[model samples]
Target: MNWMDTIENNNSVEPIEFNVVKVDHNISLAEAIQLSVEKSGYEVEFIETFYGIEMDIKIPFLVGTEDDMINVNITRDDYTITIDIDIRRPNTIEEKLDILEYVNDNNGFISFSWNNEEELSLISIWMSRERLDAVDMLLEHRLINIEMGNAYVNDDKELIQEKLAQRGELEVYRDEDLEFNLSGEWNATHGFEYRYILRDINELINAIQEERENILRFT
Candidate 1:
């Protein structure tokens, strides 16, 4: 058909749609990110220039007493986005530092780790600016990714003392026993007696603050 006929018949272009596929954690990182965007309320597309202009953006958060903060950084890499996070805590609280972080890169491999050895536990995550918001907000909900920490357990073993009650030929028939169960299936599944890992509560707030400033530098 002639080009004119194609446009006249609304055939010059066709609607575009994507197929939904299901699979395990083996998809490419790009595809994984694209899926997140598509699943979200946002649409993914390549823009030559935003607003036909180029500028810098920055964000800031408070770091009070090192016990209140969080830092999120999103940077662009080629066509992908890198997410970086820094979870900070007060040195006073580090006396009991026990944490575990889980993260997923793209969908499978491609992740890192960081040990909070400054006696002031800190967690960090880094990625592209595009996925910054998704990741930053994700911090609240948590996204399984590179983790370098430990979570305390009831490992605080406590002695279990119990007295048994028994009656034999002397009286009648009644018996009782007692025991203690710890470090078993109950505390192994991720969340059973595992708390937030920090007693400061506000410590993460500060680490994220610095991260916000870092991310804002990109916006």
Candidate 2:
């Protein structure tokens, strides 16, 4: 079943749909749509809709913070992306069963919203299966000499620092337990570029191997 069907059948909540942009002389709606899709790392296929032209794409959604796969359609009408969330509160056994059915029909989750205050930041693209498998193989064989370059500090630094302060470890990492060292660079889109230096290589290797199942599972 499609997301619209799921939302209508399972719950009464209507899908959120709003125009993100209006066709203007400076930037055509098509151009804006193309840019959005490219930045999101998702391909678009144009289709006719009553409103106007629409672009269809599937994107990953997580059950919680952890990487759990659930699929939903991201249907774009000119400048708007329509989304329907599944199972807001699975309070009953029947709802749990419905969720299972939803998972079977949907490609991945669509836990998304337009964060107007923060700007439209595109989602993270999962690592390719080949790359993940190679990383897994390296870890299994105890090949710890590797570098992942840098990662963006996507979480809240201030909150994390406060927690560490309460624990009396104002420094987030001890010298010996420094699994990776962080360095920062400012970027307008992502905010900061935190470079990583793998100190505890074995630990990271183990993590990579353990988390391998999440890679390309939706596809």
Candidate 3:
């Protein structure tokens, strides 16, 4: 079954009610993040930070097994609030390549950065209070697939070949429709960086749905 089916069929996991609100410019970023977490029915454990507040939050919808606990780190700069999670650590070159392909295909809701020294891939979603609900949905969908072990690497070569062929056929139109641009350089020493900007919540949700269709088509 696809992700939406999985979400519908599974009743053990409680649905999180995302309290989307316009971010008050007067309030601090830490307070904003904390309020969001609390509204979602999770306790926020604040981690001391020099600039903005850093905290660990557990997203219940993303948890699969008893041992599965997704760690979400929230931080902020002068302008934006950043939510970062370590999605996966690739053990082989093929796995890393698979992740890169996935990132290229579905970068609308999240941007990715790689750590060469640690072999870690970080999935980051930028959010404003107004777009928090959409961001939360996108984040949950991505993490659920990751936990299922099918978001990135596929062991079936035939399926991979079919997906590549399908993608090749749609390349021109997809490029025109999405109008995505790649900016940044990859270095052996410094690793890689990729970022994408979404204008609004509709754009983000569309990206997530398109990505889901891609996965379902292959499977």
For residues 90-145, write the lDDT of model 3, one tens digit per residue: 56777567656755664432443334446654544343321122222333456324
Cα displacement (angstroms), candidate 3, residue 148, comes to 47
Residue-level lDDT for 14 in candidate 2: 22
Off by over 4 Å in 3: 1-17, 20-29, 61-93, 113-219
Better of 1 and 3 by TM-score: 3
Instruction: Go through the candidates in order and give each one's C-alpha lDDT.
Output: 0.25, 0.28, 0.36
The prediction achieving the highest TM-score against the true structure is: 3
lDDT of 1 by residue, 1-219 (tens): 311121122112222222333335433322332353355333443222332111111112232122222222212211112223344442343322222323222122222334456554433332212121222223334432224222111111110000011112112101211000011212111221111111111223323433343322211
Question: TM-score for each prediction?
Answer: 0.19, 0.22, 0.38
lDDT, model 1: 0.25
Among all windows of ten consecutive residues in candidate 1, which has the lowest summed lDDT?
158-167
Stretches of candidate 2 exceeding 4 Å from the true structure: 1-28, 62-80, 88-219
Candidate 1's C-alpha runs over 4 A off are: 1-39, 43-80, 92-108, 114-122, 126-219
For all predictions, the C-alpha RMSD in Å is 24.3, 19.0, 18.1
Query: What would you estimate as the lDDT of candidate 3?
Result: 0.36
Model 2 is weakest, by summed lDDT over 10 consecutive residues, at 191-200
**TM-score, prediction 1:** 0.19
Query: 111 in model 2: Cα distance from truth in Å?
Result: 13
User: Considering every candidate listed, which one attains the maximal lDDT?
Assistant: 3
Comparison by lDDT, 1 against 2, better one:
2
How do all the candidates rank in terms of lDDT, highest first? Answer: 3, 2, 1
